[model samples]
Target: MSWRIGDYLDQSDLDVIVVGIDCNEGLKRLDEYGPWKSNEMSDVFSAERQSIGGEGKEYVEFIVHELKSMIDEMYRTLPGETSMAGSSMGGLISTYAACVHPHAFKRVASISSAYWFNQKEIEELIKESDLSNIERFYMDIGTKENTESMTILHT
Candidate 1:
């Protein structure tokens, strides 16, 4: 579980800081999927399939905490200006991070998010969490795919 920060830093000069969290389940799937799977930019099946069990939330929270600490120590960024974005399980985790720690990230962009993770646990979190401070949120998915899981997320 290493994070790539350069992808999100092409257009702007905001002193980008990328935080990577190691979800053991995700790593396990990646191992099974082979290193070549990492080359696919839009694949989320492996991560979504691994989003069951109790450790998911813990991993998300840990990432949020680490992100906060990184922002505080390295960039001096306030929560209102920071943006967090990811795809697939990373998207789900990014959404959870912003929702759970609203004061730490104000902008969230989730592409092909596994919103169905943990049987709507992410939805419940969004419904229950306080989000008065969040300023921006972006969610999108590929429309050509007809998979049921993607359908649910599209809706």
Candidate 2:
């Protein structure tokens, strides 16, 4: 999507820096050779299975603090200027990050998020969060996708 959005950004006069994170690094091949071989999806990204290995919290913390700090050191950034975007489970983590650190991530785009993975927890978190710091939040779901657990933000 980033590769295909240049024209749209130019037309909208949106100057932006896009950073792509490879969240699934080495997990695909790790399973073929070691005792650590396991289901990377559930281990790393699934909030519902967090007790086992849901490393999403660590991932989000790194993005919100470390990564943002590095970028801020290298460039000039204003308050509420950072944004996060992702699809599927990535979207889920992005949404989580926004809720957890709204001041750090002022804009979020969650496309087809896997809300069903931990619907109850996320819904509760959303209800408890203060999102006044967020500037823009874009959420979408495909017509063909299951809507059973899609987040229904009341604000």
Candidate 3:
């Protein structure tokens, strides 16, 4: 999927960067379920399906590398000052990136993450991940919505 860098640079000196990773499998599932709007971003990245993998974890790893390179080249941001944020499946990848590549980003904001992917695999990874240098972490989920039903997991 295409990564949409939001207009956060104009509002903060914190160098907030938002990356959108399209999850085709997730989007197709959403289409058959409900809320077609959820698939909009995924649709934009459909043409890039060949660039992504079938495994969610592998896809997340690719996104982490892409984001790090993009930020370093485009904004020249220092690893210690970079922050990443995303919603839903994006949140899952955001958290995965921070946990796996803690030095690439200092802060992570995950909104309604899909943590249920691979069952206990994610939890095991997060538990074993070294996050001593993570400056900040933000996680939130809507009480009105059943995230599990939406294939989202909030940890």
Candidate 4:
């Protein structure tokens, strides 16, 4: 997150309003169990009622456009300086937001993004997206993390 939402949200000239919706949980939410989870998986993963990080993209769009509009109307913001940041599922969505809606975000900080949720789908989306307006993007994960599963699938 950029900065906590409250009276201090717009206090600084370079301040950012870190916003988040009720995304319920993390690891499970982006993969199999979650709150803003998708109802169907991509063709690569079989079309089922499993959550596959699709809803995460939609949620980010809502925040980048609708929610940001509301915030700009209420705060003194530096136009074109908006950024999105999050950890885990939130991190995954933050990166997705920049990949799909580059114009809405100038920077993206995705800490430990769960790209393992739908590796093929997410990777394809990022590869197919227009990242011209995304000035910067940061993504990271622990070396000892669950990347083993993703690595196996790729093999």
Query: How high is each candidate's TM-score?
Result: 0.62, 0.70, 0.60, 0.67
Candidate 1's C-alpha runs over 4 A off are 1-15, 20-51, 76-80, 146-155
Q: What do the candidate models score in CA lDDT, each in turn?
A: 0.61, 0.67, 0.59, 0.66
lDDT of 4 by residue, 22-93 (tens): 554543456422123443333334544444444564566568678899988888886588888777666767
lDDT for each residue of candidate 3 in 43-122, tens digit (9 for 90 to 100)? 23476453222344455455567756776788745656777777765676667778778887788988877554333655
Clash numbers, per candidate: 0, 0, 0, 2
Question: Mind giving the per-residue lDDT tens digits that candidate 2 earns over 1-155?
Answer: 45466666767866687677754434332222111212324534346433232556767877777988888888766646889988776677778888889989889998987665556667888899999999999999988995433333221
Please say which candidate is ahead in lDDT: 1 or 4.
4
Q: Which stretches of candidate 2 lie over 4 Å from their true place?
A: 1-12, 25-53, 146-155
**Candidate number with the higher TM-score (1 or 4):** 4
lDDT of 3: 0.59
How far out, in Å, is residue 144 in model 4?
4.3
**Best first by lDDT, ranked:** 2, 4, 1, 3
Among the numbered candidates, top TM-score falls to 2
Clashing pairs in 3: none
| lDDT tens readout by residue for model 1, 55-84 | 445555555677566667777555456677
